[model samples]
Target: MAAGAPMGAGNSSRIYKGSGWKLLFPSWIIIGIFLLAPVLMMGVYSFLTKEFRGGVIWQFSLDAYDQFFFDRGLFGDEPPRLEWTYIGIFWRSIWQAGLATLACLLIGFPTAWFIATRDPKSRSTWLFLVTIPYWVNLLIRTVSMKFLIRDTGPLNEFLLSIGVIDAPLGLINTNFAVQLGLFYSYLPFMVLPIYAAVERYDFSLSEAAADLYAGRWTILRLVILPVVKPGIVAGCILVFVPSLGAFLAPDLLGGAKTFMIGSLIEEQFKGNAGNWPFGAAASMILLTIVMCVLLVYARNQNKVEAR
Candidate 1:
């Protein structure tokens, strides 16, 4: 009976281990269906020939990528010349996203630090206030922003009332308005991560540095920032990546006059262009850029861990 008991325990242990592996199957299936399958489909579509209206022809062609890198003119019979239109669009998107990220970092860092230093009972209230605006639909918030900043909007009226300016600010449909929209939309992403990091930091380090005759700037530069840098990077990535691919802000805020990468890709499929292969190619390129950014971050993180 003693030998039989050991055999039964071993059997049960094996059964438990088998069930654990079985539990992972659902997650694997979800990732395959939702993530990997779409990316693979896009990759294949990007290489395929484009149909006239809205589909792929399935035959292999480099025309989509060729069009992006080189312009063959309206007839496609002319000798190819370097394309600057798409390149300009990409540069504009990068510039907008970078500026938005910088704005968020400047505002968010101070706001996060203030929250972290608050009394424990008040911290939650402050966080709640920060997130409350996001509970409303994003489109609505964006439209409300439009109302506030337009030439005839309350902002201009208020300025006029105070004699701050002779005329309307003319903020609507401008790059500055788009930047404002992007900054408003993603500021929370910056603040929450930074707040979490600052909350975990030890103030004793600052005191110790001060005791050693370190100035306020020196302590902040050398001691505080290093410990909280991961959170700052995370916040920037969160803001910048989404801003790079954002279409709504550019569409509504910029009056659809300027095309960011997101707007350009969206227009290919949904607008009169009806070029599926080109859209897929653009998506693939955007995905590659995002992946490269993530890869660089991961490598830096690995180096930090190694040290």
Candidate 2:
């Protein structure tokens, strides 16, 4: 009976371990097949030569990387002359994304504070309203913006009717339009995180600051900002990363004037210039930049937690 008891205990232990793995097996399969496989394929494609047609050639080459930094044989075959075109596109993407993030912060902070101060029932309602735009397709939303802002659109017609201007302001297909589109699209993302932080915040600190005769600005700077810093960071990251790779807004709103990295990558793949290898290289570069940003964010978070 004692020997049989020991065997039963071992079997139960084995079954427990097996069950644990069984729970994680599907997630592992999904990550391996969907995430890891595509990334691996992209890495391989980045190194291969691009065919003149549309796909990649099997031969490994560094031409794609070179294309980003140099104009081949431009200096009478001395060396590949430095070309800033692709680098400029990356920088433009960063600039636009950063601007969009800043705009989100500017708008989101006040909106979040307003929502956070509302009654619980109203808070949910306001958040629902904020997120309602997301239910509509992004492409559709951007196109709608085009209709509203274009020269012959409703905005111009209304202004013309009101005697605000002699001619319609050329608002569409401009940088301002792009920024507006990004801000409108990502505002909810920025607001929600900050609202969560505000809801969790202790108002006692603000009260204490007020009791000490601190100015409103001082109280906000010293007490409120620190408390909600994490939310701001989270919101910034959420807005910035996606904005960096924004294609639809830049393509539809900014037009030919704004050539961001996302549009540049799209051009390489689907546009008249179908260079798959270069596109893969550009994607990898963008991935590396995003990874670096995440690493920095993680390190900062760890430091804050440590303190």
Candidate 3:
């Protein structure tokens, strides 16, 4: 989501005056006109039929909804394929996104925990080191992962040298690569929220739990997790929703055999079978999913706060 706008115009030469909510008007206007307005327009577009004459005619029709449901557009082959293609792609994207979310959580949680355990003075240095990679372009990172995992790359060379395997492990252009890319791209998202929560946790609480005869595992399961649940949930939202619609990573790190909702929608806009309204509809579907996930996350976070 984008930032909201600022409010009312001010006098150029006036002394500093009292502040009020009016200062937010400009930001609100920008968001209303840009982001929210576009969403409302897309919602309308999703309901209309896709016209072949380069524009949708102004008529009340459920053709788009029916085609989306039954996989038969108005201008398709004579005998329509009577199955919902877009819906199939949607479920596949959701499955891959689930895998990506699990991958991010597994890798990111440990990293955040490690960072949280560091001294206050050292935390910034460690976080900077981790966050620095994110500063580079995402496309560059995807390409870089490919280079590192290539058949003749150092990783393969080192494995062969150590006799860990007779041949290099096939780790590129597969689901494994897609998972890796997702983890790498979104790990910081998982880490920062968790780090913020964990870093501020009272170390004394664990000590108290231990004094009460609670073992380390017991303290972690009982005390630590509950306090940091909000951060974990926030991180999950950050990683899960974006990975669910991820396009670049799948295209760059994996083979064409794997295509995500993002890449598929991208194809609708830019490919030989380009269809803008259909792409808009597909995008809105993913967006709807994202909004639902966010709502659930926010509710959970609020409950945690209440506790």
Q: Which ten residues in a row have the lowest lDDT in candidate 2?
A: 1-10
Q: Write the per-residue lDDT of candidate 2 for residues 264-292, one digit (tens) a residue.
A: 88888895569999999999999999999
TM-score of each model, in listed order: 0.90, 0.90, 0.83
What lDDT score belongs to each candidate, Candidate 1 first?
A: 0.91, 0.91, 0.81
Candidate 3, which ten residues in sequence have the lowest lDDT sum? 1-10
Write the residue-wise lDDT of candidate 3 on 1-307 in tens digits. 1245454356443554556558989999999999999999877876665666444555556656556566544666456566557787788778888888888778788899999998889999999998999889999999999889878888898999999989988888888888888888998999999999999899999999999999999999999998888888889888888888889888988887677888887876564456556676788878988889788777876776566
Residue lDDT tens for model 1, 1-307: 3343446554557555555667789999999999999999999999999888788898999888898889999999999999998888888898999999999999999999999999999999999999999999888999999999998999999999999999999899999999999999999999999999999999999999999999999999999999999899999999999999998888888865557998888887885457888888988988998899899999999888666
> For residue 228, what is the lDDT in candidate 3?
88
Model 1: per-residue Cα lDDT at residue 22:
77
Instruction: Please list the residue runs of candidate 1 whose C-alpha ends up more than 4 Å from where it truly belongs after superposition.
Output: 1-22, 255-257
Q: Is candidate 2 or candidate 3 better by lDDT?
A: 2
CA displacement after TM-score superposition, residue 90 of candidate 3 (Å): 2.1
